[model samples]
Target: MFLPIGQVKKTGLSCHLKWFEQHEILPLYKAGQFPNALCARFIPERPDVLAVAAYDGSKIIGMAGASADTPIMWQIGIDVEKNYRGRGVGTYLVTLLKNEIINRGKLPFYGTSLSNLHSWNIAINSGFIPAWLEVETVEQENYYPCN
Candidate 1:
């Protein structure tokens, strides 16, 4: 299949929220992880928020969602399909998201597990630095059985 042209668009709150729940949120949930990423797409509308997708036809191969917590603070999360990885899609997605964040008068912030080198590289390429780091422990109460 040909690489789909990636474009950044301003999505409506209701439509974007549904997209997030289906395309982004479910992945994390299936991984036995809670929804850590802030949902920028919601009803009632948040003017300082933006939701981006890298679509190939009607399929969303990747997504980047973020919101401005304050005039100076913004946080972003990215998700790209496995087959689409290593093809610079994540980098493109984040770069577009960062530009949108900056345009809205906020500094972009991103975080990933230390072992996620691919994600780290993308963030660095997008001009972000580690604001802070921490190790997490998953106790049984929050654990899911490994298949």
Candidate 2:
């Protein structure tokens, strides 16, 4: 899930985002709002540098995170509420986050297993192509298990 930094396009949808940084986002992370974006705990290499959350009144519906995995690239992880599926919330948030990372002078990329169609669609819809797949030697690895 790589969005090539320069190609990030803002969705321009009217999304009201409240930003959060490390430690300040504990409540949301504990609630599992965006587990993929925010790690279970903070660490130096992959700190959750920034997060953009969408809300309905006061309830958070979805979140997109930019985790600094490396000095040159950041990884994006997004999760939308089950009740909000098919509503473009994931796409909107991803687009917003990706562009924001670029603005911050870092390359933003998304990552998810190939089996996750829902997440894959969100990446594609957010204008990120399947940049690369990294694998390691494993015993009986089941590639494309969704099949």
lDDT of each: 0.57, 0.80
Residue-wise C-alpha lDDT for candidate 1, range 14-131, written one tens digit per residue: 2221234233443433442113234423323422255566666666667776645555666667777777677766677677777766775666777678888877887776666666
TM-score of every model versus the real structure: 0.60, 0.83
* All-Cα superposition RMSD per candidate: 10.7, 4.4
Q: Candidate 2: where are CA atoms >4 Å away?
A: 5-9, 136-147
- Judge candidate 2 at residue 24 and give its lDDT: 76
Worst 10 residues of 2 by lDDT: 1-10
What local lDDT does model 2 show for residue 13?
63
**Deviation in Å, model 2, residue 38 alpha carbon:** 1.1
